[model samples]
Target: MERMRIAVAGASGLIGSALVRSLTSDGHEVRRLVRHEPRSADEVRWDPEKGRLDPAGLAGCEVVVNLAGAGVGDRRWTDEYKRRIHDSRVHGTAALATALASLDPAPRVFVNGSAMGLYGETGDRIVDEDSPAGTGFLPELCVEWEAAAAPARDAGVRTVLTRTGLVVARGGGAWGKLFPLFSAGLGGRMGDGRQYWSYIALHDEVAAIRHLIDRDDLSGPFNLTAPEPLTNREITAAMGRVLHRPTLFPVPAPVLRTVLGEMAGDVLGSARVVPRRLLESGFVFAFPGIEDAIRAA
Candidate 1:
């Protein structure tokens, strides 16, 4: 594959940082979109809230990836925080998409970040890229979030919405919180533990993003999850096994609700998502199972 100039928003995030490292290591030029003044030649200043970005800074980029969004599970979901989550994704995506569209020579591809929460609670039913959007705050938010990228698609860019799942990594994300608890033997199943979790290793997550960047024939939503979806109970057992810890306790759904408020619904909800599109596209996973993913983390 030939190296190309790529610009990434949210370059400081877990997946974003990993992507930048991967791209640069492969000899591709990477420009980071930052909110502050450019700290280096590779960084470009862009204020997403104000919908501002210098077109000249993005001129030579062949691909633009947008992963800019507020952390969903960072805090209690207050009305204020909910709005922050919504605006951060919708407005930020719109800002980037519009800017990409306005470029004299727009990027060939635009990979937008989305989440599996778009499917809401699927219980035991399997969902794929073609699945209809489910009900709930997250589903509604993701609907608008993906829709916000229409500008890039309308501009003839091969836009793709990556509906990522639980990314297992020791550094950050949900696994960052879980690894400590499991290591200390405090980890347990959330709620009844029947809820399914679609997970992927951080390495595989970055690999999938890179795969998307290279595949010119792919477009629209692609589920970035492991093929074998595991239940919360199975995941707890796997973590305990990997860490040589005990997984005997169970956090009741009520307590989760009391502690996490609205966010608890997502924790307890079941989403049996699969990477049907990715599999069909010939993209393979390095850590496709809970045990392997936990061990990798």
Candidate 2:
């Protein structure tokens, strides 16, 4: 792959940080769009909430990857926090997209972040990139989040909406919370354990993003998940098997709702998403099976 200058928003985030390391290791120049004052030569200041970013900062970049957004599972979804979640994604994406679109020689591609929560509760039904957007807070939020990137797309940039699933990683995301619990032998199935979870290993998540960046022909929504979808029960078993612990207990739905508030619904919701487009595009996953993903995490 040819080395090129790339600008990344959310460079400090879990996925973003991983991507930055990957891009730099590949000999690409990385410019980080930060909220605070630039602390280094590679850093540039931008406030997504205020719709402010330096257009000149992105002048020579070949690609712009927007992974800026508030984490959904970071806190209880109070009305205010809910608004923050929505605004962080929608507004941040809009700010970056608009800025990128206005550049004299716009970047060749704009890889925007999205999530599988757009499918909402699909029960046992299989969903793909072609599936219709499901209803509910997350789905609605995702719709607007993707729509905010319209400017870049409209500007003729090859914009790719990466609809990511639960990223299994030891350092961050849901797996970060799960590792300790399971290690302590307290981890068990969530709710009824029948809810399907579409997931990808952290390794594959970064690799897939890089694949999207390289494959200029691929655009629009692409589901970033392992081909095989597993139920919560299966996931629990896999973790237990990997850790040599017992998967005997199951958390009830009501308790989860009581504890996590509105976030519990997402926890118990089923989304059997598949990576049809990615498969067709010849992107092979490093860890496709649940056991492999859990072990990697």
- Which digits, one per residue and each the tens of the lDDT, describe model 1 over residues 177-253? 99999999999999999999999899999999989989999999999999989999999999998999998789999
lDDT of each: 0.92, 0.92
Q: On a 0 to 100 scale, what is the lDDT of residue 37 in model 2? A: 85
lDDT of 2 by residue, 1-297 (tens): 788999999888889999999999989999999988888999989877667787888898999999988888899999999988888789889988898889989999999999999999999899998899999999999999999999999999999999999999888788888898998898899988999999999889999999999997999999999999999999999999999988777889999999999999989999999999999999999899999988887
Q: Each candidate: how many clashes? A: 0, 0
Candidate 1 residue spans exceeding 4 A from truth: none
Q: Determine the backbone clash count of candidate 2.
A: 0
Q: Residue 199's C-alpha lDDT in candidate 2?
A: 92
